[model samples]
Target: MDYRESLSTGPEGSMQAHQVSHFFSAVDVARRGRWDDDALRQLAHLAIPEGLLGPRGNLVRADVTLAQARWYLEGLVDYAAFEQDESLRFGRLALQLWQALVAQNPQIPRDELHEVALKLATVAWSEVRARRIRHRARMTLDTRRTLWFRELDPRCYLCGYKFTAGARDRFLRRSRSPLTPPPLVDFTRPRTKERHLLIEIDHMQAVAEGGTNELDNLSLACGWCNIVKGRRGSIFDVDSRPIGMLDHPTLGWLSVPQPMWVLRIVSMRGRCEHPSGCSANLANSELLVAPYSSRGALNPANTLVFCGEHDPWKDERLISRTLVV
Candidate 1:
């Protein structure tokens, strides 16, 4: 009855998901790996019901001996790792979700079941995020500050995802910029407060940590970044360096000793930066930023910008990139 764990991944949009294929590949891999396991292989001939892994399935397998039942459930777990339809991803995640619903409405038809589930899932999630969302919903950034930031269209301080654009037309009207501050909103509009597309006014210091609403203590982030940053005492603990390179948390050993290289990075401005949607703009940055230096390829995410004076050697930053082998 040995059970093991596995990591799970989804499409790019899953996190900030990129392309991923059909989930069935997980079953393909697991079944392929288990091709030689005798008892497990025999169950494919058992023609387990429509949902071999659905709720109440334990009832159907009650007659099978301990070994048969063990491998049967184990195989379900393996296939679930790749996101089997109607099965938990791993470790029976969302345990008894459907069971709880059926407890109240035993005869609910199959067609209407998912519709009811959606309502429960939707409302339950609002309740799940309710407390955290409540705090920010009560407040909105000052319009004066928003207007200033609107002009800049700042990227999320954490993940650097873009916020939704504001209404601005072309020609006779002004064009929409990469960023435009959202109209004043509050708790009544939770999406505006928490949706990743809009800017979130996160405390540089968390309110739970006794941080305040003072201007300097606030920073911009997409809703996704703000949510992950959560109620942490300081904003610096997260993975991404939202404040830009000079302040990368654990990369202090990083340095560009040559002043000429430092000046060139600042001069390139955004030449190394891969713009949000423009693939054409992203090419060999080495040709653009530095053709001679080969320490490694530059990533736009780690590109430095000149806000003011700082020591190039001490203040310089580097983002690690995994070169595909």
Candidate 2:
């Protein structure tokens, strides 16, 4: 009536189970290379401290001993091998050992222990694959629980630049070449079906200025122009007025601000020399011709995009809002 005999597998499942358990324990507790009964017996020679030894059969607390640390490291290597080899015989045994380890001490953190169990379970699944054995998780998206969730693919709204979900997914589902940038070529006027110069589309209004992602918002930008425009508002000729901050695709023209002459008069303290009329603000760099306008009213229609030094030459009212000191 011994309870031990009732739980014993007696012969068949016992030897294979013993072989797998020995392998897992040797790696987990011993930190040794692959399990062989002969190798394990040698590892056992590395004595466990008498104080740290427990009676439940020879396991040591990983928290305190070098032996336990070695075992954990070796166990990970062994788990990784089993995972790669797709061998479940060793994995099932490993899982039993993990469960037993958790049950032995309630003080042991369960979440960390569960992480080890998951590694073993996943390793077993891989081993099943290696052995050419059939398994339930092999099929793709078999059910709702099985379906993997991911964010909708990201896209650059302004330039329509696209990126991949991840490195592996990129390989499996390599997407087609993205829509090319609008054509930059300019063919002479009389258009023929086969001979028209193509123009690439760009954001007509700046993307940041309350622009929508719709096609109507896009316009053609030549390679030359796009490079010049860069990310900033377009530049204007030195002679142009600050009020015309518009860029024309038809003529490849852009209007920007020009610096003022009074920039040379920056007082020793960095304040504008002519503080009364200009507010020290420059259209390009100079005081405004008319200082009545506030920065809130500045824009494509009135405000000019001028460098700090060049702003003074512009209509004083047309200077940047950035310099309102």
Candidate 2 stretches greater than 4 Å from native: 1-77, 90-325
Worst 10 residues of 2 by lDDT: 260-269
Clash count of each predicted structure:
8, 29
lDDT (tens digit, per residue) of candidate 2 on 1-325: 3434533635422233344454456556545544557756656664432222222112113223544543554454454444455444655645765676587656889878877767655544443343342222222222211212221432222222222334223222343333232222111111121111122234555443334434455433322233333333322212334434433233233333222211111111132334343333221122222121333222122332222344443333222222211
1-325: candidate 1 lDDT, tens digit per residue: 1111111333221221111122344445547667566634554544332232232233324423444633533332232332324332322322333445556567887547556555544433332332232344234435325533444545444433334444222111244344432443211111232243545567766654445566666666545446655753221233222222232244332232222222223323433332332222112111123212224322222333322122132232223221100
lDDT of 2: 0.34
- Candidate 2, residue 39: the lDDT equals 59
TM accuracy, model 2: 0.16
